[model samples]
Target: MSASNNTADREAKLQRNPHGDFNAVEKSRPEFEEDVEFHYTRTKDIEWVPGSGATSDDWKKHKKIAVDPYAEGRDPLNNYKLLIAGIVPRPIGFVSTESKAGIRNLAPFSYTTFVHHDPPIFCIGFASSVAAAKDTLANIMETGELTINIISEWFVEAANYTATNAPPEISEWDVSGLTPLASEKVKPPHVGESAFSVEAKLVTHHEWISKVTGKANGTLVIVEGVNFHIREDATNESFTTLDPKILKPISRLGGITYGRTTQAFEMLRPSWADEEKREEVKKILEK
Candidate 1:
């Protein structure tokens, strides 16, 4: 072969296999070889340094590493601060109930949502730790009635204020400085500032065991909606009529972030004419 042709052939061979040495190729492709022994290292080896300062004799010394409930010299507020700060933009459920003394109470709960709509059931997971839950859940259990004030962006701050740890005798409405409107169906009054509210009757009270403490810590109250009070100009003939821009409902998110339903979109299913088009496409694909 001509020297020029031989040089071109060598260049093509080098291009095909960039690593000229097989030993170098083997080192580069370690994962591809099943015969090679793999040594896995723990993340602690890479991320943490072990020394005198890292090791602790007491559980409290390891508070920076893991959560030790019984750890001494740890501030209780530290755990609460971490939880509330980390659980960000939690959905707010503004709950209202009437005390036996005829005093009305309004509170906001993050652990609340709609479970079923057939019977129009919604749930509020209230913490028994709070004095308000004792009164609110007790009242619901006694009177079999409550109201849920749907919070929008405009009223979220006021709703959050109601979540404060308050005495049972003190009304959240009075503390938060929000007006209360009499409900048509339930004893509990709705927040006058809210754009929407639902009067519901208590259907069931389910107590749940706490995973951490193993104690019956909270109660999930299922409520059945008897009446809905929507803003006069907000509703339309069709259910799709309410504008999201006006509603501006706030949603809970991870950590301290809250979400607003600012954008809306829709998707249409296949119609009779579209089904024929789909069938034509299917035939073409089959061929």
Candidate 2:
């Protein structure tokens, strides 16, 4: 085989099983436990004052080292791992799309975020360009429509299963056993199990070229959410906000780790117009 063929085989192998041993890894971990209910409580330092800084002073004692992402020995994966680790608790976009031939596709992407609210805009990052796009990105490029489902604790396992690197002929929906609900404006059906989902249309896309190789390394897709489907139990009558307790949204952490929104605290934004709050801020600034 050629050198390129060998590299491709190695990459395919790594993609299929990023973690070397699976059963042994699970065996080393603690048994799965249920009954971890969501807790709503006050902030950690409710009585905190401005300019007090971090709650703990231990952070001050530690010195920091700067990292050059393009260092001689550093590979692209090094930067990828570092960024993902530092950017904690990313929201997963469980995207569903359909090909022109009606082949359904489902996948989860950690590089997804809500960018705007007025026109309901979202950004999804793909590791490849339209020419070499994966199933999800390819489908979106072809049909210009998709459904972005929010993963929850109840169906997290099923949702995660959709990430399996299956062939184009296989539908992730069948593999994950997730039910697809009909969509209004889009041809792609949203996952019925998702409590919160949005039917989105492709607004624009940009292919990012690598500075070193001058090759298309990534694609940034901008989508506009046309319709939102929120579970009745998860939203109030006003439909302004969603209850974290009912939503049970799951977040992607570094590496193979995932996080839950079981505990939360609220903090009100202080206003300068309020004399009392203004004086407090002035005191901190003057100090």
Candidate 3:
């Protein structure tokens, strides 16, 4: 064999089993390269490339998989795994809460999102523990306060460390080696290292039973933001929009996998009032 063939053979042999433990795995660069980097002026740059658009005919020709989510006999575990994996990426809410006794707790939750902004509401979901309620959920219920920290690349490992399973008495903050700052609006402290942190007062919570487990295993807590703290280095002049390059936020993928926000593209929304779009739609209507 040629030298290149031998090298490829060795690489093939070194490929780790997908089921193998995390301790043994060969790291490699991402599949995409500079060729796939997002063009900032994406809409405007279309002029540079001919046939850049995907037409209705092109879309209709592609085959797809259809899933019946409410099927009577679907395996719940498989469904959950598929959902988590299929949802390309999800933001992590590095949550901080304090117990009635004042001991701190920290954990990363991916099942979280902004529910409302007028009341400045944020929602984070929790799964129950077999022996008791989740520490963070219990604390929020008792104290009606919590802090949310945005995970950045600078301290993602430390944020992940806080997710380890431990007794409620034991503080994850101590284990993470990340400092905390006393909150102005809430009793819980915000993560000192996080680029963005929010002090929220618990508005209310909804409890629900899990379909698979048939237990009261889910709790959705809604909190109204009282104060927001953003690192000056990561914010713009007005502190409205954040700079991704500086924030370097990390996101959750499927099990044990994390995603990095390394590239972005933009496309302006086409207004229906525009003459060209109106004419095009008119032509389609006539057809």
TM-score of each: 0.61, 0.92, 0.80
Clashes of each: 4, 0, 0
| Per-residue lDDT of model 3, residues 1-287, tens digit only | 43334435534553423556644443444443334322243443554322335433566777998888657887555566677778868889888999989889999999887888798999987755322456788888889999999998779889989977677899999988999899998999999999899999888878877676576656788899999999998898887887787777889988668887877777557665674455555665576
The sequence of per-residue lDDT tens digits that candidate 1 reaches over residues 140-183 is: 88788888877887677777787665666878888788888989
Sort by TM-score, best first. Answer: 2, 3, 1
Across residues 194-247, which tens digit of lDDT does each residue of candidate 2 receive? 999999999999999976668887899999999999999999999888988889
The candidates, ranked best first by lDDT, are 2, 3, 1
Q: List the residue pairs that clash in candidate 2.
A: none
Which stretches in model 1 have alpha-carbon errors above 4 Å? 1-91, 129-133, 211-213, 238-241, 269-287
Error of 1 at 76 (Å): 15
Tell me which of candidates 1 and 3 scores higher on TM-score.
3
| Clash pairs for candidate 1 | 88-255, 88-256, 89-252, 89-253
The model with the greatest lDDT is 2
What C-alpha lDDT, on a 0 to 100 scale, does residue 284 get in candidate 1?
54
Please tell me which predicted candidate would have the highest TM-score against the true structure. 2
Off by over 4 Å in 2: 1-20, 275-280, 285-287
